[model samples]
Target: MQEISYPEKIDPRLHIYPSQEADRLKSRLLEHHETGILDAIGRELFTRMDTAGLVPIFVLRGGLALKDAYVEAAGFGPAGVIVPWRARHTEDPTVSYASLPVVPGARYALVDTLIASGRTIIACLQALRVRVPGARVDVVAPFLATAGRERVIADAADTHIHCVWHAEDVDGDGRMVGPGFDVGDLVLGWQGRHLVWSGERGERA
Candidate 1:
């Protein structure tokens, strides 16, 4: 990777679970995906949506990851629409999400590969709310940090956060962990690349 450059100010909420634990968790995350653990998690998320009258909308993030494959095997359905969100820049880092049809008072599952700082997830959820008022949001990721979950909840009280691996599961030296070492890099390396399903199953891709 690109030498793992980091921003000047690190978020205070970041954590490093411990070296041994971090290594173990990292290995297990890969193992889970290969062993269909992530698939089960995705199915469970879908089940939750069915019960709550929500729909799944996978976020096509900018990173070069196999998120599309993971979501596809889990049965999310080719890449279609893009939900734009403002990334954290040194200057104004206001977050946003693309406008989409919102079922009145319904739930929407915002799926992504991982959540490091939760900045992007928070931005997307908040913007989504603005576009579709009164809709509940569920943030799903295969891996994420505890701080990310807390931040999402803090930013959107009605948002439900779920993940396979928490940041507390990994080891880091505070500022040097999580995004510092490129936590999602492994997904990028996973070989089963596939087109991310856009919109609903029958929707155009």
Candidate 2:
């Protein structure tokens, strides 16, 4: 949000150990940076990236922002409906699909808020596999929790991550503290088929 000049390569965080002040700041970031830039990223994907032979995946609850961002910035293909296994024991939201099955010939861009141990993303990805075996896909999460990214990379060797930012703990204090790492500040545009880089000066230069 602070004039994103480069992509951040800071390590990601997996746990949610937010302090009150951090919470307040995160709230502000949500209002200003996270939400706004999401729209910008999705629009860029639509107009700049190839969208012909892929599916847009929106995981429930958290996927709302990604969905809105995409729709507002760049309406891609028709979204194939899917909901994640919500954290157990909460009153259920009205789910469109009582049950969903993976359908082949489709690619999924798994959408979510941030990565954490990839429990959520892995679950969603597995569910897609269950519904349609061998479904080709990528993930479009808003940000990459540094901790989760390693596991994601380990679990799905071929999985791709497109994110607005990549948060990390530079001090190695085991928490995302100090100046927040901004991956967008390091790279610009799609860096590879699996990941896109943005906010980096090298690209502009």
Candidate 3:
């Protein structure tokens, strides 16, 4: 078996995404809902976020990342979750950016399937600040990369992160090392056409 590396002091905000514990959680979630286990996980995530006084906003990107966002929002009950703004950013240094319309002094919860280097989330938070000024933001994801987590922690002081698992490394394309696959790919594939991969179980793809 291959060894996986994690942070020395594991973050309390981080939860194990793929493991016996998660499987057990899934089993418990299934007692109330009939959707796939991932959706069950999304619903569970919403419950946690609600306890924290946060709302869910699905990222606009396609695939499981977006699906998980919708699923989380749906789990928020009748009124649904808030999606105050939608913005996208790139890594290109020469590119210009703009902020979207936001409610001043409002709090938002950003949801995505995975975090690679934290660039996109940072950009999104920055844009939100432009519109809402003192807006507070929380990021939620099923998985997060260590480098990405560090980058966000260093650059964005006010933003909170809630994720189920953390990995040592994730490439620019979002493929995590040791696991040797991307959660986005697996989740999106599962959501789209019923494709399945070994990485969902923490096995190399």
- Which is the leading candidate under TM-score? 3
TM-score between candidate 3 and the true structure: 0.57
Order of the predicted models by lDDT, top scorer first: 3, 2, 1
Candidate 2 lDDT at 52 equals: 57
Q: Can you write out model 1's per-residue Cα lDDT over 1-205, one digit (the tens) per residue?
A: 1121122223332221222333343455444434233344444333333333545565645222334434554444322223543322222224333534545565676777566566666767766666667777676665665566567657777766654345433233222233333333334444443343323322211
Q: Which ten residues in a row have the lowest lDDT in candidate 3?
A: 86-95
lDDT tens digits by residue: candidate 2, 1-205: 2222135443232212223333444445545555455444544434434455556776654565556656655554567556543323232222224133344566667766555446666666666665666666577664455665676667765566765445542223332333343323312232233332223211212
What lDDT would candidate 2 get against the real structure?
0.49
TM-score of each: 0.52, 0.55, 0.57
CA lDDT, candidate 1, residue 88? 20
Stretches > 4 Å off in candidate 3: 1-35, 51-53, 62-105, 172-174, 178-205
Clashes of each: 6, 20, 1
Off by over 4 Å in 2: 1-49, 86-104, 169-205
lDDT of 3 by residue, 1-205 (tens): 0132223455554444344444465344335332355565555454445433444455533123445444455444211122222222232211133333344434566677666667666766676666566767777775577877887778877777776556546655544444333344444444333332222232122
